[model samples]
Target: MHVVQAALVAFGVVFVAELGDKTQLLALGFGARHSLRRVALGLTLGYGAAGLIAVVVGAVLGAAFPQRPIEIVGGLVFIAFAVLSLRRDDDEEDDDHSGLSVGRLAMSSVIASIALTILIAEMGDKTQIATAALAARSNPVGTWIGATLGEVSSGMVGAAAGSVVGDRIPPSVLRWLSAALFALFGVSMLLGFP
Candidate 1:
């Protein structure tokens, strides 16, 4: 039951954090410009790397700070990100693409870009704190597996759709939904939702 709850929470948080994110746009743009499968590869690998880093950071911080303190910080930070999401982006996320090639370059460059973008974007985010909280409530393996699966699953869907749709979705609606989801998570964490 706890595991189930953790998985659900993990999926919800990561999925919400991903919508309207830079990495999501990157995935979409890369998908449209390149092979969807290849783009998925790059994006998945990138997101995996970032998630690993986040897990490690979450573990360390979870140890250093009490759960509530870290959660408070994370919730506050995510609120800021949510607020930013509510506004028009100064530069649309899909504005540029770095030159990418095949073989090693494809794996290295594409994956690296995705990983870096997501990592920077998610630093001190509610997603990370949720991962930590889930870890506390569930077994380590369960938490890790749930986190990995949740993020990768959502990422694949986003990458596939982003590649084909590529900004086809209504921008205003996406932003509003993203902001609402993020803010909901913040409030839930701070207030300890029932």
Candidate 2:
């Protein structure tokens, strides 16, 4: 029961945290010009590193902080992110694959850049906070594992349907749905819902 609950929180938080945002767009834009497989690999590895770091941090913080504060902070942050998402405008150019390849710098550069961005962005982000709270609910190992699994697999969830076409996943209803989920989760956490 605890594991199931942890998984739900993990999946819900990570899956919603990554939506029709800049990073996802960058990955898709890279996929548009390069081999989707390499792009996918880069994204997966980059996100894996970020998720691992987040889980570790969360585990540590959970051991140190009270649950109520963490939950409130996480919920507020998530709501802010959702509102920000509602106000965002996408108009960036694709520079993620300007000089990479299916063999050399492609995978390395992309992975490095993505991991860096996610690390910086996730430093104190709501998703990380929520993940920490979720981590707090379980043992450290389980928390880390659950968070890693949830956050890492989120990319695939966002890009699943269109990924079948050997192209990047389009920001379809998936993005909206993920955003909605996040907002809802945030409110639930704020309200201390079980």
Candidate 3:
């Protein structure tokens, strides 16, 4: 029951947070060049690896610190994430490919290239940090599963639909929605509501 609940919460938080993120834009770019299946696979693998690391670290931190303090800190972190989410400039060009030549990669290298790109991008990313915070307050296994799925789902959507989805839904709308969810989570944590 705890695992299921944690998974649901983590999924909602991460999925909302990752919408319109740079990695999703990367997915759009990559999917344009590579097979959608390959992109989805790469996204799953990359997010899974990152999610595992985050949950492990979060679990360790949760074990080390008192629950109340961890909750307070996690709440603060979520609030900070909310503010940061709103501050991001949506109009910035997303042509930066992290110097990876997407066109030159061989068929076999596509998955690896995409996976490596996603892994690199996820380092210190808001979604990763949020996953860690959620894991600290919930079940690590569930959090990892949910976070990985959430990230991969968003990326898959990007890969499948291209920029159409982004174009259809204004970035400001996603940003506001994500910010609201983060703020809600933060407030809930601060209030000691599980």
Which candidate tops lDDT?
3
Off by over 4 Å in 1: 1-9, 20-22, 62-102, 166-194
Q: Estimate each model's TM-score.
A: 0.53, 0.49, 0.59
For model 2, residues 1-194, the per-residue Cα lDDT tens digits are 36666666677666676666434543443344334554566666666665566656755655677777756875776576556434322321223544544434535654554455344345445556666676656654555555556555555443343345324344444345435655775686689762
Q: Rate the local accuracy (lDDT) of all candidates.
A: 0.57, 0.53, 0.72
lDDT of 1 by residue, 128-172 (tens): 566766665665455655666666666666667755564565667
Which portions of model 3 miss their true places by more than 4 Å?
A: 58-105, 163-194
Candidate 2: residue 30 lDDT (0-100): 36
lDDT of model number 2: 0.53
